[model samples]
Target: MIRAWKRFAAYVLISLAILVGMDMARADAGSTVAPAAGPGDAARSWAGHIAALRARA
Candidate 1:
């Protein structure tokens, strides 16, 4: 019936939206946007290592 079809369409749209939002969030979660630091920046290097460990956890 038309009502059933509409419900199915709505469910599919909502599922697609959730999938897209999760993908976007995960993509952003994977990396930092900070400018690259030189090798002399020990603090930045340590912070980067911590971030990598946290991401793995």
Candidate 2:
């Protein structure tokens, strides 16, 4: 169904976004963007958020 496809697409997009964010965070490492706790850590948390969205869909 169209709805199923839409859900899958959304999941893929969210996964990609999180990956890109982590990469960017790593690229800026040690330049203040990385932060003491690391920037990509939040990206991992986004997986949970996106998982919820996918589940809802």
Candidate 3:
């Protein structure tokens, strides 16, 4: 009774999770969003900040 209900709930939750994941994958597959930054952009940005701090000090 209680155990059977728990098992059923788990299966239902798992099935819903699988369906949601599949839907998300399909949506992302059609996305055209571009990358936010190019290679070395983070490093360049960090170096710029460090240079500014040194100049301030």
lDDT scores for all predictions? 0.65, 0.61, 0.61
Q: Looking at candidate 2, what is the lDDT of residue 31?
A: 26
lDDT of 3 by residue, 1-57 (tens): 999999999999999997665445434445333333966865654455455445545
Q: Give TM per candidate.
A: 0.52, 0.52, 0.53
lDDT of 1 by residue, 1-57 (tens): 999999999999999997665445445567544445776665664575566556757
Poorest 10 consecutive residues of model 2 by lDDT? 27-36
Candidate 3, which segments miss by more than 4 Å at Cα?
31-57
Better of 2 and 3 by TM-score: 3
List, residue by residue over 1-57, the lDDT tens digit for candidate 2: 999999999999999998786555544442224323555776755554465445545
How far is each candidate from the true structure, as Cα RMSD in Å? Answer: 11.2, 10.8, 14.7
Cα-based lDDT at residue 25, candidate 1:
49
Give the number of the best model, judged by lDDT: 1
Worst 10 residues of 3 by lDDT: 27-36
Number of colliding residue pairs in model 2: 0
